[model samples]
Target: MAQPTTSILCTDLGFEWPDGRPVLSGFHLAVGPGRTGLVGLNGAGKSTLLRLIAGELTPASGAVRIAGELAYLPQDLTVASDQRVDETLGIRAKREALHAIESGDVDERHFAALGDDWDVEERARATLDRLGLTGLHLDRTTGELSGGQAVLLHLAALLLRRPDVLLLDEPTNNLDAQARARLYDAVAAFPGVLLLVSHDRELLERVDQIADLRDGEVTWYGGNFSAYRAALAAEQESAERLVRNAEADVKRQKRDLVEATQRLAKSAAYGKARSVRRNDPKALADKLQGKGEETAGRLRGMHTERLNEAKERLAVAEEAVRDDAEIRIDLPRTAVPAGRSVLQLERVRLAYGGVVDLELRGPERVALIGRNGSGKTTLLRTVAGELAPAEGMITTPVPMRYLPQRLDVLDDEATVFRNVKAYAPAATDNDVRARLARFLFRGARADQQAGTLSGGERFRATLAALLLADPPPQLLLLDEPTNNLDLASVRQLTQALAGYRGTLVVASHDYPFLREIGITRWLEWDGGELHAVDPR
Candidate 1:
């Protein structure tokens, strides 16, 4: 595809929180027209860069330059319940003016308000329809729509603007499979400068290239998500090889230094014996000794310099290698025996009107798949005892724990250790600390307050607390667990879950994640009932 005329440029950009914590410092980026997937670990400043470009935030230093108009759809989109759909789309005045003109109002202001957007309503509806939001009334309030529908509606409004540059942050976070497909189409069709910040791999695959933001710097890659992964793997392999070579060089240098020292010691000893045998004058012997000492000093200095240089190279090579740690956990206590009655629900009416009649035995990993607002969460909540079922009986033979999407299970004021300790009250503090280390929270990190930890850290802490509960829950329930997680964190979550041998029920739209965690059974919740589905 040909490039658009638009561009985004950031020159020596700098930003810091009011508390003096710096995020970006002297950052520079220039992106011409192309779909660039911006990705990094959580809190790597992807969203910050987008917000800076969108002018929603003021950088402490430098400037953001754009060739043309820009539109931004932030991750946390909020709409008042009473806000009209037309008003949200930024066409209420124009729509009213068009109506007034059609009704024989000769007011000059009406024509000015309508301006050149004569078919604004048609265009708005078309945009909505393209995003799978057809039949939505412009006069309706935003509160009437589901969360996913509201997100699509906001995106439709942005599309209607037809700006030269578009910024999207976690656009697919709340979208279902169907809605996400529509979004992917819209994104692919956008003929402008597009910068996307998302953890959704499927969405990232649609981008023309990737701009990996790390440590307040951007590294450009020349293809989509899959290509980026391939290139990154190659780079990492080369980096690891370099590190190995550098380490070998350092060891060789050290060995050479040792051998040289040994040779010098031997040479000095022979010279001393010769001096003694020759019966040379004291001054001559002293002069010989001084020369030997000088030579030895020079040789040692040269070897030391080479060793330092080798060590420096090794440090640089090591820096090029990424160190994303994996979570390693063992929860034998959580394992459920075969033929064990994990959970049973008989004609259970969900809060949202869905009926579930199911019995899970043993350590079955069940994936509850469905569209947004399809009562998956309601069913999970009901199973967790967070919500009362409208009707029917529910039973669980083993202890259970639920990790909600919001991750509001911990007390903000308490430390991570305290939180886990709260769950495992009978366990010793040392024991809890040891287990927390397996979750990548070691020593003092376990003492960090839950409120102060980053998104990924908080998640790990929450998972540790749940899995390490006093009774060691034999049945685990998770609702939208992958929803705001970065890719690395998601992998870590998967790793942690791999060790869990209990019955698992997860409600999520992340298919790849569901597969990675080894979901044994697929159940689709639709039309107020659950139905078995093939994985294919």
Candidate 2:
């Protein structure tokens, strides 16, 4: 199929915060129909660029043009109540425009504008039902749904609009495998344009083009993430070589300039000596003029250093992304006893009004997984000694610290320094500062307000404190630990977990993260039972 004309075009686009910090500048891009995936690091102004394309914000410079009717779905959408699923779908008006059919009256110009195919309500209902919502859902309040359910509800509205272009940001977030498959189908079924932003490797594989945003510029690659990765690897190698060449050029230029400077100095001294000996005013002045021009010409060649400066600036620009260039982990170590079991629960039954058997041991890194309200978190808390099993005996290893799903462990009002201090009060001012520095929170960063930290930063600060304290915990229990972490920090934390020598148990929904850190086993949570299962 042929691609459509660019639906959105940004030429010389630039944006900066009100405080004069640059977010994106010289960002030029054009996106058309079919699938275009926007890839960027966390702070690369991706959302800002999306907002520009959506016309939600004006660019500081350059032009942004959008064509045709457009529909956009942000990462999270507010679900308005009092509207049923049927009321939200466009399929019901198969023979007429949804607005006209639903209103029972339409202006002639508007009707003509809509053209044919108005009575498509059956088609609309099928789309809704396919998404696991029913015809009765049209009358149900959308607010009374789970996160994934709410996402599906908004998607139905988007499909019904039959938009000329569609924009989705993190569309797969909070979705299960089944829901994600349905979303993929919806994207495939879209008849017009599709632009999406996602970190999902599997999702990006299906896109026709990928655009990576970095250093206030957009670099378009011809293929998916895998191709982009390959291309990036090649580009980094080239950049490194360029830097080496630039350094060599700079050094050579500096040497030549120093030599010329010395020659000019010697010439001036020689001329002085000759002028004193010749005693001829006219000849001495002539010699001075000739030497002056020669020295100036030599200095002019020194512009090579200026060119070298430009290359230096470019090198810094190229290396700005170096930190994101690789994936690495640094797992921390905590001692583990040779004892039979670090933690175990017998006949462990838990629920609002019930009981079930559960048991786990040391040397096992288990992932407790279930859909929402399945009580995966509750079971973790039970083992943490926070919540007791209603009708069973439970065993737990001491010195265990739990990182809750929400960062309740952090003190919001305190400075990051103060917060870290709270965890390890014994550390002196210098010792605490040194520990904070190890986690990349040195100097001013350690002094940053805890409330001001991003979700990822808060997790990092908490983890760093927990691990670097006076004595590390022997048992580690974490709940959805990777939820808000950026890819880089997530890799770092995963690396740390891999090296830790302790009884580990983690309850997470991040499959990739779990695999990276080497989860030893698994526990399936259903009803009120925590059953051990194979990791595979």
lDDT of 1 at 202: 89
For each candidate in turn, the TM-score is 0.89, 0.70
Report the Cα lDDT for candidate 1: 0.90
lDDT of 2 by residue, 1-536 (tens): 97457488889988875545577677788887788888776557766677778887788999888777888887536656766555555333333455764687766754664566454556566777777656434545654454566677778778777788888877765565566777887776777778888766777887888888877787899887799889888888877877777677667667766777778778777776777787768766787868776776767566556657856865774574365532232434466754536776777776443355544455567777665445666777777777867777876655677887666788878878898898888889898888777676778879877765655677778877777655667678888776545466677677667656677787765788877877777777764666777656
Model 2 residue 238 distance off true place after TM-score fit, in angstroms: 1.8
TM-score of the candidate numbered 2?
0.70
TM-score of candidate 1 relative to the true fold: 0.89
Q: Write the per-residue lDDT of candidate 1 for residues 395-481, one digit (tens) a residue.
A: 998999999866889998898999999999999988999999999889777987786565567778899999999899999998878
Instruction: State the displacement of the C-alpha of residue 365, model 2, in Å, after optimal TM-score superposition.
Output: 2.3
Off by over 4 Å in 1: 1-5, 17-21, 55-58, 79-84, 96-113, 141-147, 408-434, 442-458
